[model samples]
Target: VMGLIFAKLWSLFCNQEHKVIIVGLDNAGKTTILYQFLMNEVVHTSPTIGSNVEEIVVKNTHFLMWDIGGQESLRSSWNTYYSNTEFIILVVDSIDRERLAITKEELYRMLAHEDLRKAAVLIFANKQDMKGCMTAAEISKYLTLSSIKDHPWHIQSCCALTGEGLCQGLEWMTSRIGVR
Candidate 1:
């Protein structure tokens, strides 16, 4: 009985531990989304030069999330954080149609990395509240999300400022965690 109690306590204490990384182009609202998840409110933020990290708990699951800087020069350093990440949240600027290709390039590059082979991807089609933004389906097509056969992935339309659609995205994440 004592051993069973200890095992249950340990699982409860650790929960579904995961190392999650959020990455995208600069101005894609990665920080805002992180703040929304952390505080459920918008937090004023500037361009992240390196990364912003926080512990987020959802559905009793605990995970360390790293919101990496998305500037062009900072993109090369993203791999340094990939060691044990189990989930990848790729935020897309739904309104920046011009940069969708670049986003695709980065997504493909990250997915191609050996360290990320098993990481499940969560693509946030952010800025849904903006006018003239692309739809999630369109963005998915442009990003060729369908071609990714090795890793599990999902795309969610969201407005980080209002925290809309974020719950659904997180639900998918937690469910994925449960499966693992």
Candidate 2:
């Protein structure tokens, strides 16, 4: 009886489904990343006004994926939902060099939040299929990822249009969340 009780308690306290929040500037391919992971197809693109939530299960792990809008106005509303998130996926347009700094600032602000300090982060340098796109290393440098070097995360490159590198990003994220 004691053995069974201990097993039940251990199960209860073991790693649970991790909640992941996906955010980025408008047209950064946040939704496309999610769609590609879920449906394995790139859907029509549009700005996500508020947010889109999806539950994805792989193996024994479940992921509550929240794709949040990237508009400045929408950011105020984003704080409310960050409370329970265990991980974050930030997408950036690889071709938009001009706005890269702005994107970095926004992401920095989000990571500075006390509630999110411990959360794992995965940055998706999306739109790699486009010409003149920046590489993951360049995006990491521009975003000053080294500042958060102590934080647990990885910045991955991806081409959501053709689904290149999408699975690799997902696997990296899931691994960090103890989802293996």
Candidate 3:
């Protein structure tokens, strides 16, 4: 088992890397969603400060996911990772109840960045298990990227608390990236 682990680690160090940048507004459950995707286990987490990275392989496609800090204060430093990103995952806490508009605006601004426009975008409408939360459709409507041509996007409803919708979202996202 240890040899297998070493072989995997060795291969990772020698492989060509594919990266995905995960961004969202503060307290949007971005970290939770990332933990679920990476660790496959629920974990207690506070807001991120700058960023954290997790290496994962799904169906032999290696992924380097950068979970960037969502706080307004930390967002100013996001530009450092804009290049070489193949995908962008934006998570929003559906039950947050007040920041939906702000989330949409922030995401729009990120998408508008010249270096990021070509990145495949995926929106995770998180906390879908909560009552009175917006649906994926509602979130997309507010994002207003509905008619953006030449770019691909998907809005997936997920409950990070229970892992519901996470696998589906990841599968959809990876499939899109594979074709890109």
Best by lDDT: 1
**What overall lDDT, based on C-alpha atoms, would model 3 receive against the true structure?**
0.83
**lDDT winner, 2 or 3:** 2
lDDT (C-alpha, whole model) for all candidates: 0.94, 0.84, 0.83
TM-score of each: 0.95, 0.89, 0.87
lDDT of 3 by residue, 1-180 (tens): 999999998777556467888898888887787788888888899989988899877777677999999888888888788898878889988887588787877777777888787888888999898889989888877777687665688889998888899888779866775475
Q: Is candidate 2 or candidate 3 better by TM-score?
A: 2
Pairwise lDDT winner, candidates 1 and 2 = 1
Number of the top TM-score candidate: 1
Ranking by lDDT: 1, 2, 3
Clashing pairs in 3: none
1-180: candidate 2 lDDT, tens digit per residue: 999999897776453667889998888999988888788897996889988988866655678899999887897787777887888899999999998988988888888888787788899999998999999999999888988954687898999888998778778766776432
Off by over 4 Å in 1: 1-14, 178-180
lDDT of 1 by residue, 95-141 (tens): 99999999999999999999999999999999999999999999999
